[model samples]
Target chain A: MSEKVLMKGNEALAEAAIAAGCKHFFGYPITPQNELTAHMSKRLPKIGGTYLQAESEVAAINMVLGASAAGVRAMTSSSSPGISLKSEGLSYLAGSDLPAVIVNVQRAGPGLGGIQPSQADYWQATRAAGHGDFKLLVFAPSTVQEMVDLTGDAFALGDKYRMPAIMLSDGILGQMMEPVVMPKDSIARIPERPWAACGHGDKREHNVINSLYIEPPVLEAVIKARFEKYRLIEEKEQRCEEYLTDDADIVIVAYGASARISRSAVNAARKEGIKAGLIRPITLWPFPTKAIISRIGNAKTFLCVEMSMGQMVDDVRLIVNGKRDVRFFGRTGGMVPTPAEVLGELKKIKGGI
Target chain B: MLTIVCGHYGSGKTNFAINYALDKAKEGKRVMLADMDIVNPYFTSSEYSGILISNGVKIISPTFATTNVDVPSLPASFHSIFETNDEVVIDAGGDDVGATALGRFSKKVKEKGYEMLYVTNMYRPFTSNADDSVEMLRSIERTCGLKATAVVNNSHLKGLTNASTIIDSLEYAKDVARSAGLPLLFSVVPRSLIDQLPKDEYFYQADVYVGTIWEKGED
Candidate 1:
């Protein structure tokens, strides 16, 4: 195993991508995530990788699409508003059936809200990433180590599924530093991409990658086929971490930074003799419904904690399906909820519900 | 002493500067910390101005220091760094780009006889070796137009740091100082691990004050 070294979440993700055989990075500078881009720009050139600061987020995502279409591991990163500019490109990538990695190190949103950490982009990531019928494999990492781990997974899974994957990180996770043992830089077994549009060479048939479908049935069939992949991913890739939830009365559902706070809250609740537990979702898109459903029998109440205005609570309620009372507590617009606040909310649910 | 802290990004310079200022203040000396990092918007010393001021350390930060604004303008009171007799610590930004902001005040800083401390964490990406670390220090000096007086071996992986981590970095840090032709002033160790290591005048035991939101109170 490699020695543990301290690294910021952004730089860790960049290094993880490189270790996973990502050699192309096109991005525009944005706060909270500038370090990731800066790291790539400084390191990639020395390793003979391509790192370009595109004119804008739109240009960057399109450049990623172009590089990924050529069967290279390419990625782009941005903050909230910049991710918004990449939405059109995201939809195009989905429709074109291309594999790429997109990083959204979220800050407060709506319209250039603030630079502070925020989970407000949860809905943008999970439900409606762009104007299209598609779903991105969204991984929310709470720590710098997890950021490094999940980034490799994001690239591999995106390639395996032949669709774009989103690493939904927030400002807190992006800027904070922690001890991380980077994955060893071994030879990445890059899978053969026969369907890529890298020059035909006259030996085989030409490959065309496009999102535009002029015929209705053809587009319908393509989208339905994409949904089948989503279903398979939903069944197979649902991942989460359950903390002390085996025999608890209250189950707190959270992800990313909120999950870190919720874990502490659960611990505090247990110290007070309150039977509380936490279910932290590692994949936000898969939703980890199995973890929540399994606890529904023993858990009496479900408390959802988030850094947004209860965007993820909707999914929690949808999964609970009226089997139990699903309550939500969130602090929006760049405010983070303390463990005490979450514990208070847990106590409220324990006492009343 | 007027101390200026400069280093590559993610080298723990901000934490070192904060610890140095607070320690000076604890000795009942008037200390001031100037947050002159215009390149980075996150994790600057100005964010902890409240605690620093409460501990009796004066602060002067760039304009829109803690806000969402991304301007590079310094505060109007930045000239006070030269005006005051208080022992001042200027937390310069990372790399040559970050240190470029400090270049504007280079003449005054040199005239006042500043002890520029080049902080280094070999575990970081760019400065992972003595050669690379020395090159970075030289670049920072070129950009800031000032010479470093000493080298500070602040080598550790934040909370995961152990005695081995420090011991392992000793030679690398020494090489950095030796190659740069500067004296190894001191090495920073977490206060919790003080007993496990040998006592020395060159060891500055520091409490980890800068941390993420969840990891804050735990430290």
Candidate 2:
């Protein structure tokens, strides 16, 4: 029943948000992602939803916090610089356990590096971005369709766990135009948030939504409880996509745009009679580590391709535990390695690794 | 010296600033390209940083700030660089609202004595005529708190643009520049269509062009 339409990754994300019953959106314009804000700006009003272009990314995320606290499905988005501004809010959301969706259509960065597609923020998105020890449910989408599908899943996961969820995409995924199927009307309505700051109205005692737990023991207990929830998430929510891995000799592990590039490289390697396959992590934080580790007995080598200079390679190395030979190919600061480049690297690794 | 480029959307503002920064860096001048555009997704100067950085040009963009509820602090070195460096190029965003961020540093920039050029492409939206161009300029001036020192006419109709279209747009922008008391900086004559135009008045123009757009098959 899904209707197919050609859309950019940003537009698909906005549509998915709407379909997921997110009624509030706050964001500022930033490259590789303005289409998301623009789409929300146009459609949210018609659907009786609120859309505000906050003065800055900081204000936008805080606005999302306020909306999320009000028991409404709310979201915000940005590129690298803007996401940097929202990191504090994300930590606060994670600390407070407020369920919200944050879409980061990542662009190149160390500083305001570039607007081109980049997966450099993998560490920032997967690990604790802000000061405290907290994790965002990170979903990495390889295609525009996945961007739409995962945005809905991101909101669902956030609401289910009462935590922040991030659609960790790069500029290429955000801006590239592709065909996407709009979810059918049979999509489930999100349940009302019990922890939200909807008016108490003498129904019960006042509820406070805050990350600040002053007492050390009480804070420690809260963090321990949060970690338990993360453990549960790790057990149940580790999602990944595997292709042609049954008899493959070498496995290429990647995510987001890099996954798409790695897929092409795998296909090229297969044509040359090398048994190569791809294992793409859809959820970064609940990183399909167990699945990857399970494949290690059969796979001889693993190649980690990323847009950053070896950020995700560490994770692959950790999962493989040095049992399998691991190699890396990457391009930093907004440069996307062509499929040919990735294929050439695979050729170099075919016999050696 | 800082060379700031400002313009409407799709005016090739980023394109000019990026190539100019690269050119200066090639000339052995330490150049830095700062992208201040927070609007418009398709075009911005920050996209060229990888190439510029590899070529030894210092590229500063807004992407460095972390997402937090608080206003993220910028690097301390940025301010020091302007005081010490001989060459700097700031590529402001397309819309007037995007250009407003430059106002925060306008006083410091003026103290440092930098030149700001307003890039005008008559074929673009909101600046197709003299009145429209003037209104756009006034909005930019109000936002930045400084008047544009010069105007660079960079007219094009996307893929359909020709030399005549460029000439006509330049004429329209020239009138606006005269009335605003700003110097007509130069025209961007694409090398592909450069030979078709008369070389009399625009002979001294800097042929502002970037290599063909990076398509998938080129590499």
Query: Which candidate wins on DockQ?
Result: 1
Off by over 4 Å in 2: B1-219
- Please tell me how candidate 1 rates in CAPRI terms: medium
Instruction: List residue ranges in candidate 1 displaced over 4 A.
Output: none
Residue A86 error for model 2, in Å? Answer: 1.1
TM-score of every model versus the real structure: 0.97, 0.65
- Please write out the lDDT profile of model 1 over residues B79-125, one tens digit for every residue: 98898999999999989999999999999998888899999997786
Please, what are the lDDT tens digits per residue for candidate 2 over residues A1-353?
11234455787789889988987999998777887898799789998999999999999999999999889999999998888989889999888899999999988887887777788888898885798888889999988789988988998888999999999998877765554667853594788766677887789866789999889999999999999999999999999999999888889898988888778778778889888889999999899998798899999988899998988888889889889999999998777887888888888877675
Worst 10 residues of 2 chain A by lDDT: A1-10
Q: What fraction of the native interface does candidate 1 get right in terms of contacts?
A: 0.46
Q: What does candidate 1's lDDT look like per residue over A193-277, in tens digits?
A: 8889998779898889999999999999989999999999999999999999998999999999899988888888898999998
The positional error of residue B202 in candidate 1, measured at the CA in angstroms, is 2.1
DockQ of each: 0.53, 0.04
